[model samples]
Target: MKTFLFRSMIGIFFGAFLAVAITNCAVYFGGQELLDGETFLKNSLGSIFCGWFFTVSPLYFELKNLRLSQQTALHFMTVTILYFSLSFWIGWIPLHLKSILFFSGMFLTTYAIIWLSFYFYFKNIAKKLNQDLENI
Candidate 1:
């Protein structure tokens, strides 16, 4: 539970950061005016909620006896469904085919990079543990 909370909080922060950055970029490029404080807060809160949804999958899949590949597949599917659904709901992404395709591609690529990075990180830790075990 502690780990879950910690991870979720981290996700929330990360998501908020990305949301703000993206919004700034949009405003700059699209020549849109800055959002009102209430609107910005609402959007940020929604983003944090979406972030929690995104992070839950990884924690849920971290069970014993599951292969890394299986975990990755499950995570991918869960994030795919949750992200698209949430984005559509929040109007961050349009429900049109072109928008869907573009966002889907971006999401998959980003998640794949994240998953691989975590995979290698844990693999290195496991390797270090095995070395220590061998020395004992």
Candidate 2:
């Protein structure tokens, strides 16, 4: 529980940071004024909520009962849908076919990247642990 809270705090910090960074980059590059303070606050809070929800949702599931492939597929689909809906609702993404497709592609790419990175990291840790056990 303490670990979960710690991770949630980190996730919210990064999520808010990413949200601001991306918005700042887009507005700066486009030569547009920043969003009004209230709007920016809303967006930032939305991002924080999204991050919290994402972490909590996965914890509610019993992924250990599923195979690795199943877990990956479930995580991919759930996260993609959850993010799409949240983004669209919060006006980060537009509600149109092209926007949906583009967002989906981007989400899928990032999801795969993060998932594969963790997959390899944990696999390496397990391998090292096995070697140590053998030495013992």
Q: Best candidate, TM-score-wise? A: 2
- Model 2: clashing residue pairs? none
TM-score quality measure for candidate 1: 0.72
The clash numbers for all candidates, in the given order, read: 0, 0
> Candidate 2's residue-wise lDDT over 62-116, tens digit each?
5577888777677667776777777888898998899889877887788779778
Q: In model 1, which runs have C-alpha deviations exceeding 4 angstroms?
A: 13-42
Which pairs clash (backbone N, Cα, C closer than 3 Å) in model 1?
none
Q: Give candidate 2's TM-score.
A: 0.73
User: TM-score for all predictions?
Assistant: 0.72, 0.73
